[model samples]
Target: MVIPIHDKNPVSRAPVVTYGLIIANVVVFLLGPIAFAGPDPDAGRKARENAYLYHYGAIPSQLLGGAHGGHGAPVWPAFTAIFVHAGWIHLLGNMLFLYIFGNNVEDQFGRVHYLLFYIVGGALSTYAFAWANPTANAPLVGASGAIAAVLGAYAFLFPQARVTLLLPFLWFLPLRVPAWLVLGFWFVMQLPEFQQTIGVSSSSDVAYYAHVSGFVLGLVYAALVIGRGRGPDDPLRLRQKAESEGSGTPPLAPDYRSADPDDPYGQYHR
Candidate 1:
């Protein structure tokens, strides 16, 4: 899995929405496990503890009425699940990717538009997964689908932009690669996995279809939304002008430290 570490182009606007999303996801995960605490310590221990996720988790079967389970109270799991995570690794991974890619996309869409894009992207992704596996009975959760949208937007808006990645071959080594090369490669890789899961009989525990669908939607949405802006030559022209005038590689990575002085999460870095 090629994870993005940094973007080649920095955003001109604030990343309040991005950081807020990170905080929201973290808070939901913390509350989910505790809120859904079960009664029997052994019999339904796992089920009770994960009640919040199981009931609210995006289950294709439940959406299609092929299965039954999920919270009846509040009835907001569909949207809430986006913030809930199964574990620390899941939470951290999603937050990290969001922090890395979200800012630039936010810059492109502006805060309000970016927020809308994220929610709609996630909702679309969930619908895609439900459509693909309507009969499967499994709870789907995670911000991956939404984050995939951001990556898709990043791919289109800044294809020439570079990303700093840690290539794990023998040792952990950091290398810079063009965004198109990394994200495009990732977008292509999802197709095969999506195809393989097409006719499976068993319910897929993982929502792979959601990721693929969200990515495609993101690409289409970005093309329609951000594509109208300055042509592809604009960024290159600006970069060239900056370089000729003795500026460092185009402002790809934002100075997060200064962007949010009291960044409560403490994850933002320069």
Candidate 2:
């Protein structure tokens, strides 16, 4: 019920890569059987959908030792599957998350580094799922794995930022909360999914392994590589330290008083 709708964080640069990714997924979906019926006169809607998924989606069985039931090398699907989705709900959910969190992370890392991080994180996530469910025949699709990376990066870089959430029961009212609280809760909720049998894919409908692995990879990479081990942003603080030897009063903090318009703390700064 704690659905995130938006973040109070703002970015300095345009997120071309994020926008491009969304567009690409939309285009692919529109071209697929889900939106436009395929050219196969003999195939039914379900058959065409299955054919598309089998060809583009990543199958853990193929990724492991099983014979390739898909076209081309198995590696191709590992990457291509990032754009594929099982249904309209799947596509929209992933795209919504990416649009919400990707801007700030893209700005923090710059387009190039962020792009590489997203792609690699997604690819690795697929492999992580495949490793855990080596014998499972389900073909993994959708951009959840990549979007999870963006969520991790956003949580790291803007922990103090406020996220607006809309509860399904209270659809008319929006609640604003800290980024850390929201993202931390999200990561924690995924932990229990690990208890599902590792090699048994039928235990869960969602790819929890990929979701967790992608999140960890994004967070670790952001900390160690991109952010250089930097910790989360501290909240705005109030202090009465001596300003100068000559100045009698501790001089009211300039930044603390006059907040930047984009500051997440509203009227304060650290």
Candidate 3:
């Protein structure tokens, strides 16, 4: 298995939208019934979880018609499903991707646009999943689809940026590689899963269709709509400016630092 550690790219702004999205997902997961703080069942922990997931999850049948699983899935659950994670591992995995890749995209699109893109991309992806499995009854949950969009945008906009990945095959060795290669590998990995609409015959709960659709949509949208946003306040300029202010480098880059100062992603020299 491969796990992304961090990226070399830095953002021009504070990425409050990314931070806010993370906070919102975490809050939803904690407050939701799938967190096990729900109405305690006499038994069947798994049953309660299944019930909870299907209740709030975006069921293809409900979204597309011919409802199954006793009752219909939540009304228009695409938006709600993005905030609901089925388990701790699910929550952490999605959040990790979001945290690692989301900031730069948010910076590129600014807060509002990025947030709208995220929500719309996620909803569209969920619908794509539903379209494939029109008869499926299982509910789809988690923010993977939206995070996949962030990955797509990041890959397209910062193809040369370095991303450090932890490779479990090599005993968790850290491998630093270009963003395109990392994202390309991710795309290739999702290919087989893409053959199936999520929740059809798959025992696993992963929404691979959503991931594929969101990634493609985000990539296309990044190219057509955002297109890197490398004007006056580009990432390179911010990095250079940040370095010059702190390091001994000459102050040749434009100043784009926010009025409030504390930046955790310290000055990048190279």
Task: State how far residue 124 of model 2 sits from its true place (Å).
Answer: 0.4
Worst 10 residues of 3 by lDDT: 257-266
Local lDDT at 55 for model 3:
72
Q: Which tens-of-lDDT digit does each residue in 118-183 have in candidate 3?
A: 998898899899998888877888898888888898888778677778998799987777789988
Q: Which residue pairs show collisions in model 1? A: 8-252, 9-252, 10-251, 10-252, 55-70, 55-71
Clash count, candidate 3 = 0
lDDT of the structure predicted as candidate 3: 0.76
Model 1: worst 10 consecutive residues (lDDT sum): 257-266
For lDDT, the strongest prediction is: 3
Please rank every candidate by TM-score, starting with the best.
Answer: 2, 3, 1
Per-residue lDDT tens digits for candidate 1, residues 1-270, read 666666545566679999999999988877766434434356566756566567767776666564446355423445656777877777898898899889888977889999999987886788688788777655788898899889888878777665777766636576667778888777766675544566424334557678788888888888886776656455544665666798753565332222233532223333
The residue ranges of model 3 lying beyond 4 angstroms of the native Cα positions read 36-47, 66-75, 193-203, 228-270
Clashes of each: 6, 0, 0
- Candidate 1 Cα deviation (angstroms), residue 209: 1.0
Model 3 compared with the native: what TM-score?
0.78
The residue-by-residue lDDT of candidate 2 on 90-122, one tens digit each, is 788888888878887887788998888888889
